[model samples]
Target: MNSSRGVLELPPVVGRFVDGVGTFLADDVDEGRPIRCRFLWSAITPTSCRWEQAFSTYGGRGWETNWVMEFTRTGRDCTNNG
Candidate 1:
């Protein structure tokens, strides 16, 4: 993830990813406080997608979105690795 600050390095998140949607969860410490983090990914198109990060105070309940990112193709074809 990239922000005005810089790239972000997230901890090891574990979850399931199926089709064009994915949900990842992890436990992290923010500002010396323990919290639960969630990262969701959704595919909009072959060349576009959406990603967001949220925080939960109690497990998976009551989530507050902290960041969101949208990605689009930049004229770089990735259909073929050749």
Candidate 2:
């Protein structure tokens, strides 16, 4: 886990980090193991360090970052035989 200042380095989980204009789109599709995340903070930006980066770059507080939806796949939906 690598970190600088208040930047948190969470263990990599199965997911996609899509690069947007300002914000990043995180699609957590790994149902078997959801993206478990933890974080550190900075004195200047106390609320959420990464939040600002994600919000500012992706367009800032608006209708876009309203809500995050997660989809679940059932037995048959998962074709992989493990």
Candidate 3:
């Protein structure tokens, strides 16, 4: 998403940072069926990072990657107003 918005479905549930990987787990419903959601984020470099969103229908036993994105910072100065 190239925007910021509020998502109550994904509450602020912090996960313990281990081995440079940060994860967030939450429960969600899909098509009236219960499912597990996981958001994984890891740093690939100082200016780049990888993020993925996966879902587990097998009671958190296995996860299937549903979405993924690589964020690489551009050369433009984002902090500048000019």
Candidate 4:
């Protein structure tokens, strides 16, 4: 990871770092395996944000994806209350 400040910045709501765990087909062919992913938020606003993720398998090559999403605030919490 780079130590230089201001290299990446994000809003408080977007979080500085995010992590995800899942399984995906290797090369879109093989059986799914556990994958760990990390995301860094580079830009964020009240209604939109942009980030990128790096994914790595337990014993395989890594991949990445960039994402941008627009959000609308519903008066609901971000958790499963049911």
**What would the per-residue lDDT of candidate 3 be over residues 1-82, giving only the tens digit for each residue?**
2134554455345565679888888887787788888888888688899999998999789999999999998878878854
TM-scores across all candidates?
Answer: 0.73, 0.18, 0.77, 0.29
Q: Which ranges of candidate 1 are over 4 A from the true structure?
A: 1-9, 76-82
Whole-model lDDT, model 1:
0.86
Error of 2 at 23 (Å): 5.1
What's the candidate order when arranged by decreasing TM-score? 3, 1, 4, 2
Model 3 residue runs over 4 Å out of place are: 1-12
lDDT of 2 by residue, 8-70 (tens): 543333333334213333322223443323221223232222322111222323323323333
Which residue segments of model 4 deviate by more than 4 Å?
Answer: 1-30, 58-62, 66-82
What is candidate 1's lDDT per residue for 1-82, written digit by digit as tens? 4476698958799988788689999998776778899999997687799999999877778899999999998886668853
Give the winner by lDDT.
1
Q: Put down candidate 4 lDDT per residue, 1-82, tens digits, no spaces.
A: 2246646532122233435322223222123555545454544556545555555564335565545344455657769773
Candidate 4 lands at a TM-score of: 0.29
Q: What global local distance difference test value does model 2 have?
A: 0.31
Q: Where is model 2 more than 4 Å wrong at Cα?
A: 1-64, 78-82
* Displacement of the residue 25 alpha carbon in candidate 2, Å: 7.2
Tell me the lDDT of candidate 4: 0.44
Worst 10 residues of 1 by lDDT: 73-82
RMSD of each: 4.7, 17.3, 4.1, 14.7
